[model samples]
Target chain A: GAGVSQSPSNKVTEKGKDVELRCDPISGHTALYWYRQSLGQGLEFLIYFQGNSAPDKSGLPSDRFSAERTGGSVSTLTIQRTQQEDSAVYLCASSLVGSQGNYEQYFGPGTRLTVT
Target chain B: SQQGEEDPQALSIQEGENATMNCSYKTSINNLQWYRQNSGRGLVHLILIRSNEREKHSGRLRVTLDTSKKSSSLLITASRAADTASYFCATAITGRRALTFGSGTRLQVQP
Candidate 1:
């Protein structure tokens, strides 16, 4: 009955530093996604992972953005060489399945990253 | 590129009044979903309307999709103060893994 959860509700880091945001999806969820919301970018999809397949990284703005899901349950989004433009709320969501079918996604509270 | 665009960036209404928000998208979509977020927190799924279906209702919320126009509208009847939040429209494109979201509309339901 637990919903998706994220850690470090807020994070502040210096430019050029690396930051990692964590997400724990609901039980039985086979699909996970990460999105970013900023003053300038609004809300944009960053990455997606479905089952054991390769994750979709098309939305990742640059090579510095990377994510990994361990054991198909939890995911961590890492941003290297952070820039002020990367400052935003990092949100995570999970669904029973992937884009093959229409399903509702459960979202986490999100981690607000501030690159100073 | 943003696929969906919500109209009237902000809206204000009294409790018990109805509220309506519109969304327009650029490309064809398989379905459209509405989500509500309180403050800057995580989003809560409100409703989903498929391209084949013209309209759907859940509790006090009504959603209508016009695939021909690539647009949709969400109407909340008898809104309450608790309904005050930011509403967004997200479109699921064919063969796409992720949903594209609109800028969102801020609704303030005054009690």
Candidate 2:
């Protein structure tokens, strides 16, 4: 069984440019999440999508950060006008069922975004 | 901001020794999970302890949760060099899909 997978292992772009990171969750897993990890820091929640319910975007730091999960399987995180502060590892995770009691999340290798 | 805080930010020990890391949280949780990360990449799920359970064991890993104290501990026994990595504790509160994670404990197992 394939675990969660992310695209573009490493990406370096100008601070003003936009970057899109992609994630493919495991089959039959209806819950997907995005997180950001800065240098020597812990994981920060970004967004969460469970089934057809409205996605939880409260963890998004700013309006510049946005994410979308199409067909309830693949998710794309878009950062507009990236700042140097946006440089960090973007990780995606998925779980079997997103119920409140479910705690296991399989994570992807992550996409390292570097805003130069 | 993280809801959990892990003590002893970093640790170094011999391969055959045991390593213990503690975590404290500030809110009620349905479950607590432990994850391991290598080279700052994706996290590998190690163990999950439900709120009702005080202790759980998997292989050489032991996890304990004390809802009354809002704290938990992860112990790795007879660690090997391959066990060297950053370990984090995440809390899943009731009704929330996203987890709150602690900074993590960096453990180095010297062979």
Candidate 3:
């Protein structure tokens, strides 16, 4: 009964560099989501993947932000040309979608990305 | 654009006292959920209240939703010092796949 998990608890990189954050969802979870949280601010929805369907990338701020969920389990969020504004904690969550509806999401320890 | 907004950015209370936080959203929602975060890290799911549900309870937590007002409230009864954390309200808008979160309320429970 492991929960969602993320890699690189903290990452510090220079501006214009590219950074990738990874997430491993819980077993049997068909839906996965990524969100970003700035300091003293709320979480911003980034992208979502449901099963084999297309991923929802509407919330992504720019073209540089993109994510891919491979084999319906692990997801990787990559930010190209990272800017100072991209400095924030990246959170990943997963949930089960059943006949009733989408249930509560289980979140993983976020990866704090610092663009210096 | 942020859909949900929480009131009283911060609150302080003593252990055994109740804590109540409110959230108001801009558009209609399918469901509202409460989450708690510690040390500004990952969040933990607290409760979920559907649009049709007026109120729901889990342990010491009580959540209420008013679809007409597009608002929700989370009340923790007889709180403990361990409950000190940042609370947020996230809304799943109608016809939306992702949830929009509020700016959260920092609750400080003094033991």
The best candidate by lDDT is: 2
**TM-score, cand. 1 vs. native:** 0.97
TM-score of 2: 0.98
| Model 2 C-alpha lDDT per residue in residues B12-73, reported as the tens digit of each score | 99999999999999989999999999999999999999999999999999999999999999
Instruction: Encode model 2's per-residue lDDT on A1-116: one tens digit a residue.
Output: 59899999999999899999999999999999999999888999999999999999999999999999999999999999999999999999999888883659999999999999
Q: Which candidate should be chosen as best, given DockQ against the real structure?
A: 2
Reference-based lDDT, residue A115, model 2: 94
Worst 10 residues of 1 chain B by lDDT: B1-10
As a whole number from 0 to 100, the lDDT of residue A29 in candidate 2 is 92
Encode model 3's per-residue lDDT on A10-37: one tens digit a residue.
9999999999999999999999999999
**Fnat for each model:** 0.47, 0.79, 0.61
- TM per model? 0.97, 0.98, 0.96
Rank order (by TM-score, best first)? 2, 1, 3
Q: Candidate 1's residue-wise lDDT over A1-116, tens digit each? A: 49999999999999999999999999999999999999633479999999999999999999999999999999999999999999999999999887743777788999999999
Candidate 3 residue pairs that clash = none
